[model samples]
Target chain A: MTTIQNRQILLAKRPAGMPTEENFSFVETAVPKLQAGQLLVNTLYLSVDPYMRGRMNDRKTYVPPYALNEMITGGVVGQVEESLAEGFVPGDIVLGNFGWALYNVAAAASVKKVNPDLAPISTALGVLGMPGLTAYYGLLDIGQPKEGETVVVSGAAGAVGMLVGQIAKIKGARAVGIAGSDEKINYLVEELGFDAAVNYKKGDLRQQLKEACPSGVDIYFDNVGGTVSDAVLSLINKGTRIPLCGRISLYNLEQADIGPRIQTQLLINSALMQGFIVSNYAEQAEEGLNQMAQWLKEGKINYTETITEGFDNIPKAFLGLFCGENTGKQLIKIADPAR
Target chain B: MTTIQNRQILLAKRPAGMPTEENFSFVETAVPKLQAGQLLVNTLYLSVDPYMRGRMNDRKTYVPPYALNEMITGGVVGQVEESLAEGFVPGDIVLGNFGWALYNVAAAASVKKVNPDLAPISTALGVLGMPGLTAYYGLLDIGQPKEGETVVVSGAAGAVGMLVGQIAKIKGARAVGIAGSDEKINYLVEELGFDAAVNYKKGDLRQQLKEACPSGVDIYFDNVGGTVSDAVLSLINKGTRIPLCGRISLYNLEQADIGPRIQTQLLINSALMQGFIVSNYAEQAEEGLNQMAQWLKEGKINYTETITEGFDNIPKAFLGLFCGENTGKQLIKIADPAR
Candidate 1:
């Protein structure tokens, strides 16, 4: 048997604030042989997301914190290089939480086969995957955007935010996007058909948001919580629904972020605010994926990926998420499958 | 018709922060004649609540702000002195939104008859009225306290809070009360049958609340929002429900109240928080009142009123609400019905 070397990235230390390159360590090790009911996967695409930052801390979150020096795990699209499992065959494209590694020996039950012909193999890690499912349930179930209602999305150019705004529009609601840059704002409004887009980095956010939402905000899909959220919350109308999907803006703070208390605003409008993770709807993920895939096929939905080439650039891609360096999904390409 | 002298308390000026005696002005005028379909009612019990503080400001809320120099209106129990209406007659006791006055001539449609035979007439201003209904819908519909769940109520000795804690117990949930004083704490535990009670004004509130709730809080009925709520929020469990009924602490603040942003906490726990007024559940009020009356009959629910005697004392009574001088409902007694 030929020996294969695997390159992996590990969390060197828990971050005190914004993570730097020093927080990650790289290693090379021999890929382990797959036992019975196990499959060897060669990583193709690795997803980098904002929620991964929470897992780096020592504190408990929805997912357990990563131990120091351990390989970090996240959504990965790969090809089965070898299979000792009954259901999987070599050359099958698959997706699993095999993480920041070039190769992984995972149990068959942990990985699901992805059809490359369906859309694209990488879509399994972005739109047809966790980020798409996140936007689906959070917007339709929690935000409940009604027809003719105004729906405002923060971090509107990011993976989940972009999909959320588009989904709101498909539901017959007016979609307003709030992005950090003018270019992202233009892309969201002009290319994605967002009803309006505001650059949070420019002008008065409150005034810009107010001008964007003439009927007052009925649904707020929040991915960036901070002053941006505070501004949107101030404009919420009666029965407003806020699906709190992420707080990327405050994720790097070393101390607690302070702002005006939102209880009074919520009470005055009889509003609803809920926080959720995509896994919360795991039971309904299939249905959500079907609808999302149909939307993609019909040209009602579209997605873009900011791909960083090479295995060693995974950490760089992950850190770039904090700086809003990605327009949609952020991924690192490891290697193409052997034909 | 003989002319009668009426004494009214008008909102002299909107309060800058906490209200004072000067914010109210007493005026004397002729009691308007009862026209067709109108009933001339003499005020019996005038309710004072934390929600009224919002109305005293020139800012909009779920209810409109009180206009300066206009008579302030709220829930009031009165006796019909004369009636030209079909359903109401002289000597009928009723409840209406005619407030801060010794007398009023209101349309028959505005006031509903209170059955003095079912409960004390004052209960129409407390247990069988708006406060009780507020606790019912906010706790049952929003809080959704299931059996064996831990339910925490801030301002647990106040009008709506007392009922909220009691309702949690009736549903077989553990009730934890947070009050400002030892007396109120004792009333919650010993008299009202709350499972555990903590005095927020005492040493180490977070530690005390942690001790009182062996299980993490699952439902929080928040009447007081400040440090007390911040402590409770820190201990909330997965799927926790918070019904934001009032924010008495922030109501008097002249500036924005700053606190740790709660979106991350809500996301980490996958929780839901909703704010509601009792009027949102108006259609279900009859079912709520009937159940409350049954509970009272079965000794499952009990209420107390901190009553102030005389029409001249209404301003003092309204001021006392901010100081937490009331145990349960606070009402000003204008006059007893003349036999």
Candidate 2:
């Protein structure tokens, strides 16, 4: 057998604040021969999510921190190159938590087959995969958007936020989006059918948000927590529900920023704010995925992705998340599957 | 009917910081003649609670803000001196939302009879009243404490906090109390049967809290929000529940204080923090009060009070709440049951 060489990216240093390309290093190594019950997979698509930033810090979050000088692990859609397991065959598309590399050696149990007939294979890492399920349970289970109620989502053009807005609309609620750029705002309102969208960088956020949500915010899907969230929180109605998902805006800060306390706001309004990760509802993953896929098939929802070509750009794609450079799901398109 | 002069307390001014005696003004008014379905009640005990602090700031809360120059209203246990309604009663102990006055004229339907045979009539304003229900529903409903979990209550010596700790214990959870004084801490551990207690005034709150809750906090009944709540928040375990019942520590501030943001902490742990007034569970008030009464009857919970004598001292007792002067339920003992 000719040894296949793998190009892997590793965490060179733990970031103090904003991460730079210097924090990552690339190395070339020969892919290991698969043991029985193991499969050799070729990376086709890799997901770069805001949550990966939390893994970079030495502190533990819901998931354990990524160790320094180790291969970074994330969601990757791959094609089985060779398999020793009974269920998987060569040329089968699979999804697994694999390294930022050209190839992965995984136990057959760790990877699941992706049915291409449902959607594009890349959607397995984004719209039909983890991000989709995240938006599903977080918004429906926690947010509980009611008919005619207002649901304001921050990071509205991001993968989860875009789905959150459309799902709110499907529930007969008024969907409002808060994004950093007017271009993303346009995509949220015009493309995703959000009732209103605000550009946090443009004018007065409080006034713009007030004009957007005339009836007051009933459910706030918090993704980017900072001054933009501060503006949305001030407009919460009585019985408001805030699903605390991700705080990407605060992920890279060296010093924790002090802000206005929201406890009193929640108190006076008799509101509820609950934080959750998708794995909290891991038992219902299949059900959630089916529902999200149905919405896609019925044209009740739309998905957008910003794909960067080649494996070397994964770190740059991830860093761009902090500056709101990606449209929706950011992905690194590795080589296409070999026949 | 001869005119009966009533000594009523009104909101003289909205306090910018800590409320003083100057914020309350005494006015003399005549008690009107009783019409059909009316009762003339003599105030026996007036309950002073931390929640009233939010109502005094001229901002709308769960209850509307106290209007300036109007009478200050709160929980009052009274003796019906005369009644023209069907429940024909003289010397019947009753509970009503009444003004801070020596006497109140109320519609018969507005006040509920307090049975003296069950407990002291004052218990209708304390342990079996709004404060007790606040503690019960907030801790049991929102906190949802599981057996063997560690539950921490801030402002642990106050009316609601004291009851929250005891209810947590009733649910078979380990109860930890956070108070300001050594005397209060000793009371919590000795008299209230708290598994552990921390004095915020003592050296190293974080160290003391860590030692007290070695397993980390599973539930935090936040009665006083500020630096103490922040300290408790930092040590939360996964799936921790925080019921934001009040924020007495932050109420008197001239300006909103900037503090460490808690959303990230909540997100990382997949925790929940809900704000609620007791009225949020108004439909279940009777059931909550019945359960609380049963617990009291079984000696599973205890009650305490710090009674200030005379109607003239109501304002002083209210002001003392912010300074942590009361050991338990604070009330004014106003001319006991008019014979």
Candidate 3:
């Protein structure tokens, strides 16, 4: 038997606004020897989500604070290298809350093994995972888009936004997307079949949104809040529904500042804005995954991966999310156990 | 034949913030004789909802603004003195959108005949009317309370709030209320059957709310939006739903004062806060009314009304709303049609 070691990214300090390189530190440590009911995992892909910002702050919130000097944990896809559990495995792919680490050891029951024959293992961190499930329930369950309705999704070229806009189109509704770059906009409209794509960096969003959706937006899938939310909110039609999935734009702010009062507008249009955390629908995760996978196989749903080469670039990968650098689902790939 | 003219309350000027009696002037006008397809109504009761504040402003809204020097209009219950249209006749009690006037001449189709044998015609302006319907759909459709879930409603002793709390209890959920006065608090708990009531003006609302709703709030029916909305927001359970029916607390404010930053809290809890206009649910009005009427008859649902005497005191009644002087539904008793 060969002894194993792991390299992980730990939180060096809590961030004030935007996280810097100094906030994360790379550390190499020997992987603890597998005890009874424990399995050694070789991480294949690590997910970087917007919510991690909340965990980084040592403040009172829904989830516990990410302790300093601890590995930054999130959804990860891994290959089982060795197991001391009943189900002996030498090369089985699994998924769980692993961290920004190359290899680690966890209890066998803590990780769920994935079927590679069905879909790529990396998908367990993306479209067949949390972001995909968020788009599904947030749009269909909360927003409840009806036929002929106009659905506007911000961060349109990103992982969850792309799926949300595509699903809206599949449901026979008008899909409008808002992305940062022209390339992302092109991908959303030309490649992803969105009705319109607005480049938020370009000025006159309110005017562009009004022109693109003459009838007014019926559903707003809010991923990037702030000015985008305010602009989209002003153009909503009567009885509009807003599914608040993520507010990536405001995640870095120390405190919320005075902005255009959307509350007054909400009263006028009788519009609805609701925030959702994907974990609330965990019990129904299988249902969402099954449906999403089926749509993906039928080419009805589309997804892309913004991959960084190694675990060392994990900080860059995470910081890149705040800058809107990644094209789709931001992920970091580790060593392939099969090799 | 008595041909006495009607006295009407006209808006002399648009209010800047809190409306004063000086802004309105009562004027004697000749009552137009009923023509073909018209009905002459002796107004009995006129509703004073918080939404009227928007109408008081000469700006674009879901409904048209009240014209300067024209009679302020809203939900009204009256008795038909004369009619030329089919189905409607003299002595019929009806409800419609009539102004703050002793007499009104309108198209017969504009009025809905109410059966006095079934319930008091004045109720058509209170629990059996717009306020009840507002509470009904706002709580059930938007709030979506589930069994054993904790539901908290602001303005709990008032018309809409009282009904929301009761409805929450009926759905097998714990109902907590927040009111201004100790009397209202007692009434909410002892009379209306609210599981708990918080006097927002008396004590630490955040602490009181925490102790009141130990399990956390699943649905929050918000009629008063300010610090209370912020407090309720902090204590919301994951996937909680907020039905923002009214913001009586903020109607008078001029500047863009910043309330607590709730976007972060919303993201953490995955709570949903939606602003709703009851007219959006017009399609379901019949169903809402039927269910509410049934509930009222069975004594399962209860409501209170703060009736102000005289059409001349219409402005006073309107002003009373902003001060939270009214307990339940606020109405202006225009005249006793039988007298």
Supply DockQ values for each candidate: 0.89, 0.89, 0.48
- Model 2, B166-223: lDDT tens digits are 9999999999999999999999999989999999988989999999999999999999
Candidate 2: Cα lDDT at A44: 96
Model 3, residue B22: displacement in angstroms?
4.2
lDDT, candidate 2, at B183? 94
For candidate 1, lDDT tens digit of each residue in A56-98? 9999988899989999999999999899999889999999998
| Winning model by DockQ | 1
What is chain B's TM-score across the candidates, in the order shown?
0.99, 0.98, 0.97
Question: Which of the two, 1 or 3, has more DockQ?
Answer: 1
lDDT of 3 by residue, A94-207 (tens): 898886788878888898988898888888888999889999999998889999999999988887999999999989999999999999999988888999999999989999
Candidate 3 chain A TM is 0.97
User: How much is the lDDT of residue A20 in candidate 1?
Assistant: 93
Model 1's DockQ?
Answer: 0.89
Docking class of 3: acceptable
lDDT of 3 at B89: 78
Q: Which regions of candidate 2 fall more than 4 Å away from where they truly are?
A: none
